[model samples]
Target: IFFVSIKLTVPLAYFYILLILVRELCEKFPGSLYIPIQTYLPYLASVVSTMQKSSTFVEVWAIIEALFYICLRLHIQWLQYKDPLEASLSSAPMLELWERRQLWERIMEIETDDPVSFVTGWFFDQDLQHITRYDVLDFVAWSMFEGRNQEHLTGDELGQLHDFVDELEWKISEHLNRSDSLIPEKNTDKNEVGDNRKDNQETPITSEFTQEKNDLDLSDGISSPRRDQGDRPRNQFRFPENVDDDSPDFFTNLYENYHNWYEQTKDRLENSDFHPVQGIRNYMAEKRQQIVEKEKNAMATASNLAENAYNRLVSPGSNMDKQLMALSHATQSQLMDAWNSMVEMKERLETAKFVSSKRKVLQQQLRGYRHLLDSARAMSSAIPSNQMADLMRKITQCNEAIERVEWSARDAFVKATGYARKNILQRTEPQRYAKYSHDPLLGISTYPLMFHLLILGVTDGGLRVILRRRGFERRTMGPIAYYFHPGSSDHTEDENEELNDEDREMTPIVFCHGIGIGLLFYLPLIDEMLRLGRPIFLPEIPYVTGFRPWQSP
Candidate 1:
């Protein structure tokens, strides 16, 4: 009995001491329990039953040893089941609206000399939305023209530009055709209504027609032709009411003209005899002369205004203060008129087709108005201090507005020429795995190898089983495998009933292991965390697991 007791009691006492030590440590840490006390209840009951039945020390020790091995086996099974790396693959999340906007902003910020190649490479094998694709196409198209001379471009570069423009035009044409197809359906419905109420709606129809005509005249800056009532068609189709009557037809004509111009430019590029550069230089010289003449006229007007102000100031029986005020008011009025003209020019530029000649003319007119405003500003400096301050403030505001208009005009032109429809029709499969070279076991520690061979497998298997029992589901997203538990829903009813307000409000924890022994090493910590009743996400990083150096996802 003494020999048997020594053999059984020593191991049993050691196990009890270890358990006590663990309990004490858990108490000290305040919420960390490696294994809950309930886990030992079966062992405790068996020991009590053996002692009560007067069982021999050898039998008692055999029973204790068997129970210990059984517990170890259960742990190994749990580890295998709960392993995140073993999870199945899931689909990647779609990009949100704000994320796409941010992506576009970042793409626009990228500056490169070869924008076409850069854009194509960036978008290759990637799915993009229609508007986003168009925005990119427009940016590339405008970039080709920006600060680039047609004569200087190589054959390949010119061809590329031409091809991109053709694509852009095709996209625009497709959109217009789609819009046209929808138009007749809407018009037919309107025609049916008009036919049914012909007599009763005549007065209203006539009034609506007159209103539409007035609107077209005001917006298009062209008067509608007068037609006799007898000449009107019985089934006249009306377009959908829009701010710009030009709409699809105007854009279609503009693109067509641009295409012709592009063909002519391409021909010029190919021909050595025709010097388009020389013609462009001559045109620029003529514009410069016109600008000089306009500047002279502005100077003359300023001189005349000064002379009139001087005459008023020196004339007998004339109030000096009143004349100065009048001069200031006149200068302010001229500045206001110049600002209004700039605003009108800006509006025209925005609405006008992206024709080079029309853009240059409007830009020239804008410069002339700006010069006039500057001249008016210079004249106003001689006025009273208070009036000068007001004038300067107004001038600043006018300058800012003009700058914004110029930016808007540039953006509009780019959008008109550069944009194209979506190029990607279908998305390709996402990359799932990465290739890595194998490393030899020259410097690797022998202890880790031994531990993994002898101990790690069983522990990992047990951890997996434990996790599965706790209702954690495994899935793979892209290259990473992960385990997820839905917290409250996964928990038993008793556990949910036991949860406090704080536990209910606790945010989900994302637990990722470092470059060590993988997640199996963190089982104790994870087990403690599970008690909080919060959802957990565990993504497996294979490269850092130390088990496999070659195979990685």
Candidate 2:
């Protein structure tokens, strides 16, 4: 019945609009009539009836609607694609859980209906393949535990269920790995471009690196390098002879130990021969020892009294000179090591775009290393000795190179994550992508003209007024916080009479906006008054309101 009505109504509607256009054209120029649509009306009617009976018109309407939506989607994509920065910034990472609520609900429903089918079919579905692999593992684990509760299930059935779950977990991992590998390599290129563009703009880093003591002369603010030269009263600092050669190499050892421990722990967990608590405690202790030793060695390398004393004595210079040079060299070597560490960390961060929090940590670490590098350079320049100072400057240069690498790594991570998120959303839920991509364009295009009255007022010299009741400390002020504009809504008669009076009769309104926000805070109210052609008065307050620097009380 629905199809029959659609078939009948659509053709008649199209014909009705065509006849109206034809009538208007004929009336405007009687002699210009060409096709003579009136003569073919009966034939058109017969064709329409035939199409209705066969329901062929339904397909025609469908095709037309498809074309219309296609054009709409294209326009939306063009608007979003034209502004790439906006698109990247607006990429949603948790879109699957939030905006794709319907899809999640459907998955849960399917899982409830047949847990086994859900577990097996989930990995096969491409749209859902990018979802967190652990989430799938959890679901499979739950399904297995529930199956174990069924009294009707035999030992063979339970064993098969465990086997199926293991296979499903393996497949899910494979799918996630494939998805991660598919993340485009453009992130690295973007990082390079960002580094190059920010080279000149990285003044903060360069200045920080070359920063010096400013207390040499307060009156002239002139830097006196020699004034602080004799300030080093002791030769207490020293550098290890092989400071530059030592590489810590902690991550490699950590990874190896972790992998071996993980495999052994997995076997132990599955065997369940020993008590669970004691076995878990033993596994944890082994892991803790691995990490604790690595950290202890790293800290010892940073400061060792015996090693520093040996390096200083071997130099055989004036005690102070030898100590200064050794200290400079040690600082330089530490800066270089930090630089190398940051580069490696950034690369790892870029390659692993699955966790956003990891990227944030990498960024923070990069910033800290960069700051240390700059401080080394600044402190080097402040040293009076040329040789020691030169070493410090070299350290600064090494840090700058590391900074570039760090920036690239961060850029790569951000870009990769954004790319992955977009692809995942686009594949799993196209409507969500279309909505997110096009909604901004729609808002920009339609916002100003959404209400035709605003458009009409622009040319008509009419102002739009808005009346709002404001709350302050639980008390309400009605009509006091009002927007007055041309053609705006009417207010009380008393207010209108005063507004019309040649001589101002009403008391001037004094707006007391709370907080450090000064006159600029009341700009909206000021604008309304300007529109109404009224005078504005601004009173100066000592430290609270007008012309006052912001200060915390």
Candidate 3:
């Protein structure tokens, strides 16, 4: 009898568990699980009936279990097909300005032969959707042309590119607007459902009925915004007119207004006789005066605290240590304020558009900060021994801050006076072999050549193993991989031995591979150079070696 009771309870327990799981799935997916539930309701009813009647209960239970498993599998597959990007957008009213800027930067960094395919692959990898390949390609092309000042392009081409960009921007705006409209409705519905569930929890039967009604309403595309509004209190604080609190659209508009204001300010400063460098100097002078006042106040406070501590030593419950700690904190705070002021002055000097004379003035201001730092350090010795650790830390920090300011000032002066030289040996033109001028159909015609390349690659791997055995060391520097073999002379026994008159100078050979299958074809040349008793260096240019075609050399 005990075994029979346990057997009966197990099936009922499973039925209840399945019901709970289905309810959770419905809540999680919202409007997505309606069709699956409708199709399986009959099977669920039969299973419940069989459990009650005890006739063919095992067979019916197995069948229902199989159907549930199948439904779950289908649901998972459906979830995989859903566009996560669209889902995220639906949850939010609009993208933040920073997020949009980051997205634009990522799009600009795409350096590929096929922008469309490259962007498409990225979207699929990132689980994004709603952005088409053509739109991405158009944006990339327009950005590239604009960066180059539309060089080598006709006027018609430029006009067409501009039109493409305008259309793409319009489409994005429309999509965002649509999201803004739909998200509020969804949020209201969710709030109403939550409130309804809370109210129904007192009676299980009523809760079940309410759950069914909510699911039905969701499937029929209905919401209760009026009910939600009626539930809200009238005395709640509201946002100001023409303002959207924490909304991206509002922030973007604010940013544009700020930018326009900055431009006007810059233009006014440029047109006026007032020099920005002079203003910076005046600001620095005021800050220095404030720092001097703070130092004097700190010294007075410390001296007064010490005298008070001496007087309180004779009293009960004096708390002299606490008073000393407070004084130390106050002094540290003053030092921190001074350091912050110096940092701000440095930033202002760097940002000011100044000539050589103005730069010299900024340098003088920086030197003043350094002198202040020296004085602060000298004054730190007066701090109590117990508090010396924290004071010393603050002094070190101030020293670092002043050093940074001096370095930035010098860098700014160099930039203003054109003292820094640029690298002249860097390549300016694109490589001929790197150009993607060949027809894509050539890939199909050259299909058989891939086998030959694969064989060469395998042979190259084997040759590398042999080179490793022959005392050659392979290493990587950034993106370039090279093989180095210190020649026989490097391992000579006598360090101070002079060369004989008959011996000539031996120089190492540095060989770089071209646009082909890497160093596999140059083994013979390497061998010949190695026989001359000189070191051999072979740097592998993977980007031009046909294997790493996606990379830029």
Could you tell which candidate, 1 or 2, scores higher by TM-score? 1
Cα deviation of 518 in candidate 2 (Å)? 56
What are the Cα lDDT values of the candidates?
Answer: 0.47, 0.40, 0.46
Least well predicted 10-residue stretch by lDDT in candidate 3: 430-439
* Model 3 spans with C-alpha error above 4 angstroms: 1-460, 489-503, 550-553
**Poorest lDDT segment (10 consecutive residues) of candidate 2:** 232-241
Candidate 3 per-residue C-alpha lDDT over 94-145 given as tens digits, one digit per residue, 9 for 90 to 100: 3223444455445534422233344335345321133433434333443443
- Model 2 TM-score, 2 decimals: 0.18
Look at candidate 3 and give me any clashing residue pairs: none
Q: What is the lDDT of residue 121 in candidate 2?
A: 54
What TM-score fits each model?
0.20, 0.18, 0.20
What would the per-residue lDDT of candidate 2 be over residues 42-104, giving only the tens digit for each residue?
Answer: 564444334434444645554454454445456555655553322322222212112333443
Taking the tens digit of each residue's C-alpha lDDT, what string does model 1 give over 1-553? 7445534644564465454444446456633442443355656434433344443564544455545545544544553453121111111222333453354335433522233334334445332221243333334433433222232233444454444433332233223323333433234576675564343233322332212211211132211121211222222212123332111133334443655665687597768666554565577679879989988898787978876877776774468767878999998799677666656544444354444444445457546554554454346333343343343334444444544444444445456445433431222222211111111123432122223344456655675787788788878976678889876645777977887877778689999899876777887888877777788998877657764533332
Q: Identify the runs in model 1 with alpha carbons over 4 angstroms from their true place.
A: 1-94, 97-459, 465-510, 537-539
Q: Give RMSD to native, each candidate.
A: 29.1, 34.4, 34.4
